[model samples]
Target chain A: MSESPSQPAQRRTALDALHRTLGATMTDFAGWDMPLRYASEREEHQAVRTRAGLFDLSHMGEITVTGPQAGEVLDYALVGHLSALAVGRARYTMICAADGGIVDDLIVYRLGDQEFMVVANASNAQVVLDAVTGRAARFDAAVRDDRDAYALLAVQGPESPGILKSLTDADLDGLKYYAGLPGTVAGVPALIARTGYTGEDGFELFVAPADAERLWQALTGAGADKGLVPCGLSCRDTLRLEAGMPLYGHELTTALTPFDAGLGRVVKFDKPGDFVGREALTAAAEKAAATPPRKLVGLVAQGRRVPRAGYPVTDASGAVVGEVTSGAPSPTLGVPIAMAYVDAALAAPGSAGVAVDIRGAQEPHEVVALPFYKRER
Target chain B: MSINPEQLRYSKEHEWLSAPEAGVATVGITSHAADALGDVVFVQLPEVGATVSAGETCGELESTKSVSDLYSPVSGEVTEVNQDVVDDPSLVNSAPFEGGWLFKVRESAEGADLLTAAEYDAFIAG
Candidate 1:
């Protein structure tokens, strides 16, 4: 209960007013004033699991690529086969440097034959934009940084689609997974995408920044019948962690190659003949095909004390092994869950258990297959 | 949420102490203390019967975001432990004063410098 020492440099979102009204504890996240949690983290977490949760994600960056060579430009920049993505479809892609290290992972949405909208994590938006626009110059395409103009809201959970459908006439069922549609909700034009980080059926709504509050209120009003509650970044972490989704700085890094992240499938060497990082990716792929890098694995801590981030993992003989990347006492699992990178040889399920020195004491843990939990939706 | 004025007094550390019938006061953390700590996932309570000195670190309470330690408001032996909080630790956060209480202490001194309701609230506010 010490005072928050630092002030956030980033501007507050349209939800800041609402957050204040709801008595949210604000924290500086990626330069943005974001709510850490509304009330209890576990309570917020349980709501998302058993019901629906809405997220204020206006800080995320949306880059619009529209030109005759838009697809060609993206095909050159991203690891995923962007050229094959049809209009109104979205695919998860990683933008990488020429050295085969990932610059950023983004969702590339093919809005038209020549228009692609790339949604990147808030912190890395500028970097992704620079890389995309820089590459676009070589292919005669245009890139627009649309971060300020729009706000993104995620309505995530098992009940999300049902609640969202009640507000709009845009046949949400027709919009397949990883697809999007432009429609109006409560007389407000919005772009609804059937995509989210939560391991539940949901929609990510992108709307005008000025209209963010109104859109949020409207959805909450419409979604009241379906039990939608506004969630914060605290629960967002647990939800994504349960789904085994990687946070930018935690799992993925500019130095870590795609193959190291179990996302090598995103690199399409055969697509478009050659692209940025193609040679490097092929080299890395060949290098990986022979001897892969250390793999990331999930661990279930034996005790109630969670193995937090930066905690060292040790073998049976007290030999320092890997480090814990993400960990928490999973509200859903009712136990401590963690993810760590270990030697590929030792990453197999049930190979052996390890101990995490929680403070000065050794807390035992076992390697488990990732995602700690999942739903069919 | 009732401020039990006489049953137990409070500390800036958010600990509460019920005056012992004799010299052994029973100490536990308050409900506000638990909510401020967020979801109580793991609590490293001092061993039962472990000696604790006043204004000293007793044990740790780890939440999803950070780790905080409970302080011994009065020097004593950890005569009794709260197993309910240890098993379902969130009880500490949900009901910090009652079922969420951390531990009971057999005080070394007859009395501790406990804060009144107004004092603890003002300390928390500042």
Candidate 2:
């Protein structure tokens, strides 16, 4: 979530011109030219919690697996029980290496009986593509990298339904969470999914690249009175942090298994057939259940100083026990919250002897639950 | 770029120092610094009676994006700290020159030379 190091080149999304025209602070995110924020990040963060916010997520990679054995192939490729997923439903799962380390967490949306869309993070797009493709080589399925062919947009928040209802003829009221369907939005073909990372009611619209700008314009215009604003990666980070959603590089990483990140529920052990990382993850799960090394927990700083990623987490005596993964000054909670990997003994809420080393000063904090904020439904 | 106040002296670290009166001068970060840092979430000011040196980091400022050190423009003993800004850090961004003043410092015997508004402007432009 910090600044990217200088790279040789960067890629632009379909709405690059639109974002630049609106004076977005462009940053290099996983080699893609993406907006960090359009206006005040705090204001944008608050807007999403209160009203609505639009996001250009074209950089997120999409891979399609289609054929008779597509579901079986995904069951072998990912940690979730994809073969049992009903059509039009989405499952949050992770693609892991053979050793059970997380490669990437994904949202697998079953578009049809033989078709499923795997949305991966921008940094892990190619990794997921290669992993899924290689895993499906033996199955009667075809894995196609459709990232460059589609543009993704997300309108998230409380007022999302009303704003999106104005643009699309689809049954926004009936769209259940984690379900997706093909429909025309703003006169453009799209796959509208009732899923979001912000932990709010929202839709993730997938459209063709050429129609991205038009879709964005239509949403902004239709959402004028709904308090929808163009949000960027900055506010998105804080929002997800507040919601306790894990980002790939932060909460989930290659070095940590799904069990270590407290995401062992995504691993389906009862599924038939040997899947990649199944044996190793099973062992890791058993060991973790016995005596977990470290677990992810929420931390709220008692003082003003915000504990950032990679900062050392200290015990009562100021001994380094863990490290912070993601943190921000939450606009909704009016306090600084963070996710850290601490010893399992100290992972419970209100555990004592917890502090964050904020630039050599051991600022005390309280270990709270995963999410610091939850919207009233 | 925002205009640098003519009455206040400047520091290369993007801090503004008011002319010392009664051996005390006020301190605050410039608008440019606030703009670069985005909305300020936390401001750590030097405690009263603490001795600081010119061009040294005395405290820290944190934003949503990252953290930056608050540099002391002139060496002095910290006299007063702004409790308002310490409570509501956004004052540093909304009213940086007035209510956002971080602290007041009593000048040392060996006063430090600082930049004029034009010189600071030229320095930032370069």
Candidate 3:
């Protein structure tokens, strides 16, 4: 029988049934039917900071680059030196257009000498795949979009190690940050990576789509005492925001280059051969180093009034300077914080006269450095 | 949590107003609006002595999700604005009818369009 026409045609993750049974508040996110929150967003945000939180990140795109020239192709496609990356290590990089605009920020994991996996944002997965494929036309590497073949899960926070120790025989202790290795986790063949977006010591397990539900069950069962709660996109957003991570659609967009986002370091101008956007990025980076036009900074509001996205950021005389990209009432800081792009002259932390136009009132705010919160470890 | 006191008059905008005594009425958002707004974080109320018209936007209710306009339910001059709820906005979500009252208005004319509790419940239900 045909489905009702009014029903939303959203792609379901492998853990869809599990989320539904847990009473998750389901919502459509980037064409994927995902959970917005399993409980109170504040409670979930606190759980990831204090204890541990499990996340179903299956919607994120995973692309595999293989062949002898894989690293070379990555070097050509992204703004990082991927060829020199040691095996099993990962690098945070970005794909840019020819004009030096950011296409998407990505995490490229060097699995082996000739194999690398690129993890792209959910909304930009297809674009990344097409860009990488087009960039590899002159190289010997073969780019394959392997998104549907894997289910990604993350166990994040201070209690992550203890919670995962009971489920895997892999050397969880030896796994370093920004690294991943193929290993058995919870008796399932998986790529156990010590990487996460939460700015906490954590593991991201990449396994076959069919093994996802089993892995989730095992992790929850093993982590029952470690305060492992099923977290949704809401807390994940705030956690990454606290960490000052740039989300693709928010902090990093196609119109803005890495240099404009205070991430010029990710662009390796010294890398050999002509990479995409090298000349423009070189000029942009040089200009930014000399005198940046604008800079992204953190803002902390005094009152409870939240400075939401698209809110205008103003100067002392109430002159519009920039705009807020991402904001929320910080569950960790117990106040409202935001990331905004402001004029370079006033980008320094504690700069005077920064305020967010919340509705009609200009709420006073203090400019601060990025990453509002960080783990002690 | 969805209590609609029988004695209180409600507006289609989900505000409740106490029956006028000496032309003064206590006004607040109903439980239905509170539940819809989830957790209230901030509230901006009309200044005392400011004249207000029924069904007009006078203040705002900021929640975590988004900001919404608080419509004045009756035409009158504002008498008292609730400072207690303004100090702690969650009262709007907790005790929306009691400690969470927004402002009092001395009515020039009773809100003829205000609904009875039964009608208000039916309106929200629909």
Candidate with best TM-score: 2
- Point to the candidate with the largest DockQ: 2
> Residue A272: error of model 2 in Å?
2.7
Q: Give each prediction's DockQ, rounded to 2 decimals.
A: 0.69, 0.79, 0.39
Specify the CAPRI tier of model 1. medium
Query: How does each model score on TM-score?
Result: 0.92, 0.94, 0.89
Report the CAPRI category for model 2. Answer: medium
Compute the DockQ of candidate 1.
Answer: 0.69
Q: Report RMSD (Å) for each prediction in the order shown.
A: 2.9, 2.8, 3.2
lDDT tens readout by residue for model 2, B1-126: 448889999888989999889999999999888877888998989999999888899999999989999999988899999999989999998989899999999988323657889998888888
Ranked by TM-score from best down, the candidates are 2, 1, 3
lDDT of 1 by residue, B71-108 (tens): 88888788788888788877876776677777777777
CAPRI accuracy category, model 3:
acceptable
lDDT of 1 by residue, A1-377 (tens): 45466954567997889989988877778889998888887777777787788889888899999888888888888888887898889898899999998888899888888888999998899999998888888777899999887889998888887788778899888999999888987677888899998777788999998788888898888778776788888889988898898888888988888898888998888887568898888888888789977788998987777788888887778777787889887888888888888777778877675778777777888888899988864
**Which lDDT value does model 1 have at A67?**
87
Q: Tens digit of lDDT per residue, candidate 3, span A1-377? A: 57689975889999999999998877788889998888666777788889999999999999999999999999999999999999989999999999999999999999999999999999999999999999999999899989999999999998999988898888888889999989988899999999999888899999999999999999999989888999988788889988998888889998888999899999998998889999899888888888877789999999878898899999999999999999987878978889999998888999999999988899999999988988897
What tens-digit string does per-residue lDDT give for candidate 2 at A165-184? 99888988778999999999
- lDDT assessment of candidate 1: 0.83
| Of 1 and 3, the candidate ranking higher by lDDT | 3
lDDT of 2 at A377: 92
Please give the range of 10 consecutive residues that has the lowest summed lDDT in model 1 chain A. A1-10
